[model samples]
Target: MAEEKLLEIKDLHVTVDGTEVLKGVSLSVGEGEIHALFGPNGSGKTTLLNTVIGFARYHVTQGSIWFKGQDITNATIDERARLGVGISFQRPPTIRGVTLRSLISFSSPSLTDEEIERTAERLDAREFLDREINAGLSGGEMKRTEMLQIILQSPDFVCLDEPESGVDLENMALIGKAARIALGRDSFDGAGCRSIKSRRADYKAGLVITHTGQIMDHIFVDKGHVLMNGEIVCSGNAAELLGEIRSHGYTECFRCAGCAGRRA
Candidate 1:
């Protein structure tokens, strides 16, 4: 028997400001699997993530979003989140008075104070959590905080948009470590390790959107899809697709008649 599906998106069509952004997009993710969405800038990667999380501005004119076994095409953002869907925005918002600690604690009340502190430390977000949310935070700091929230929430499915954008050589390893912990790898010590492992077991599905493919090198990306003009043009194993993208950008792979003919 095949593994049960965790997320199902069928004939997904989305438009923003009267301009079509996603055209007949269809994809599925199974439990315990990682699916990578790769595309050039403005290729609708973020649009798809927003649509999955029920962003109101991007209208889903047609299609449906199913989670676990329920149709959630019209669910609100908070509704989807409570139902085990979480998203880390490519450009996270900055709330003036909200502290990172408060926001994270509010989202995940199960975490102990020490667990939260350890999580922040692993993501290199220990310093910023006490500060205003995303206020005066560097790009890497914002990314780390986003990763921290996903870890704490332990959602069934996570949507990560450009997870490695602002990371530099110095802190890239730390970010990668945190991502591995979220993916269920056992590398930490004490309660942190146990908590992360439990979260990993609970986190059965994910949609990772990346441009540089650097994240794939660190984590095991199960499948990859190439997006262009708001549509998936090609899908393949993570290793093969990452190689193609690295050698030649999305233009060469997405536009090639031969590559486009094959399904992901």
Candidate 2:
């Protein structure tokens, strides 16, 4: 039997500001599988994620994006959000007038104050809760803020961009824990030991874009793909592909992916 696909993109072409950024890209993430996307800077990795959730400026010129058997090629961002699609941006914006506390209510209206405070503490965001959303936050803090939203809302499909970037070792563990919570997985063992299973077993389906693949150290990566020149050029074992890219660089990915035509 084949795995159930939760998110599917077929020959997806996207144009941003009149420039074609994603050219005929296609991929599928299985239900409960965490897939990692890798690429060099400006390779359309972010474009792919933004387009999936209907980022306004990115016009889908061709193909279709389907979530859980529904075509969302023309769905509005809010429409997609209502369908349980959540994304944590690499750089989130600051909403000067809106406090994170209020924004949490917007994301999960029924969440109690106790639940909010506990997640805040788990993400080291107790102080940030009262601050304006993303206002004066460090990169790590911004990432944590986004994670907090995703956790409270419990989105079915999570899109993460570089959750490990700018995060210290201590904080990386916390971010990983938050990711687990968002995915509805066990974060701790019975004896109070953090689960060695953070990167394994039950998980929600989603795609993650990783520059350093450091997030893979914390979350389970079932498969990995390399995107080059706006197309997915390679796919393989998550950890193994990450290791290959680390040792030989992305040129190795192009060579191995049989994408020599795009290398120049």
Candidate 3:
């Protein structure tokens, strides 16, 4: 039996600032599967993520986006969040008045104070919970805090943009572990491992965008796609694709003639 698809992007064409960024991009992520997206800078990688999360600036001029079989192409960000879609931006904004603890609670109202505290502690972020969200924090600190909120949000589908962009090795490891927990994989205490079928039934899925592929060392990714010139050119095993991209660069992907009009 095959797993149900959690996210489907079909022929997506997005425009930002009056210029098209995503050109007919399409990809599908099955429940319990984590897909890695690799592309050079300015390849519309972030544009695709922002568009999926329903950012207004990323206008969808054509195509559709579906979540859990529901058409969410025109859904508002709040509506999408309520439907269990959460995203961690590459460069999140700072809210001077709101503390991290407050934002985490707001992200998931059902989470108890103790539960939030435990998650923060697990991420080694207990000390910063009372501080303003993303205000005056170091690069690694910001990434870890973002991961903590993501875990607390506990969304069924997670879209992480460059989670390992500026973090150090130690912080990257912590972020990776928290990411696994958010996706219903292993937890911080080294337990809570679930089978792929079980995870799928629970609707846990993730799509991570990375340039260095360092995060792949910590979290398990089912597949990878190369996005260049605003289109996915190759799709295959995550590790293998990463290796090829590392060895020959994205120029190697041009040989495949792009994944146009085909589902990943």
Candidate 4:
């Protein structure tokens, strides 16, 4: 039997405000696969992720978004979330009056306070649990906290935006580890040691965005996509594409308008 397609965006056109941000883009990540989306600033990477997960303000002017075989072009954000889609934001909001402790408890109703403490401790977040979410948190702290939420939620399809954006080396490893754990790649070693999640990880799929591409060092990527000027200029081997970008920058392989160099 063939594995089901976990998330699919076909010829999607998206606009923020009156201006179109994504001209026409298509991509897919199958069950248990992780796809890396790479692009320069203003290339529509965040717009695409925000669209796929159905952030209402990002109106889809044309095309379709299908997740787990259902077209969800017009689905509500909560609808998409209930269908096993989860995202760790690059800049998570600072919700007033909601402590991280309360947030975690809400995410996993069955978890005991003791287990929550252990989870927070593992992420070195014990101190911030009582703090308002994202309130006074450093960039790295915000990333880790959101990752912990995603782990607890155990969404089937995950979207990671700039998982390594502002973190130092230590937090980068922690964030990477959390991402791997969310995607089910860090579940167990050959020696049978467990990863963070106590339950054996269910099959998970992911769409990850990277500016520095550091997250790729931790999470194995099955596919790579380049989006420029609101469209996907190319899709190919993740490692090869990243190496190409590193060697010559994004222009060396972009096919979009106003970009020069060979096709990526």
Identify the candidate with maximal lDDT. 3
Point to the candidate with the largest TM-score.
Answer: 3
Q: TM-score for each prediction?
A: 0.91, 0.90, 0.92, 0.90
Q: Per-residue lDDT of 35-99 in model 4, one digit per residue for the tens?
A: 99999999999999998888878999899999989998999988888888999999899999999
Kindly give the number of clashing pairs for every candidate.
1, 1, 0, 0
TM-score of 1: 0.91
RMSD of each: 2.8, 3.5, 2.7, 3.8
**Of 1 and 4, the candidate ranking higher by TM-score:** 1
For model 1, the local distance difference test gives 0.83
lDDT score at residue 208, model 4, on the 0-100 scale: 95
**Tens digits of lDDT, candidate 3, 147-239:** 888888888899999998789886777888777777777767775666433534564799999998888888889989889888887788888
lDDT of candidate 1 over 1-264, digit per residue (tens):
877889999999999999999999999998878899988889899999999999899899999999989999999989999999988877899999989899888888878889999878866679988888899888888888988998788788888898898888787777776676666553555344455546433545789998888887677888899889988889878677777777777778645544555564
**Predicted structure 2: lDDT:** 0.83
lDDT of 4 at 1: 79
lDDT of 4 at 142: 87
Output the worst ten-in-a-row residue range by lDDT, candidate 1: 185-194
Q: What does candidate 2's lDDT look like per residue over 1-264, in tens digits?
A: 887788999999999999999989888888888889999999999999999888899999899999989999999998999998999888888899999999998878999999899878877888999999998888788878888888888788999888887788878888887776676564423222135334433467778999888777767788888998888878878787787788789877557643434332
Residue 140, model 3, lDDT: 82
State the lDDT at 124 in candidate 1: 64
The collision pairs in model 1 are 235-264
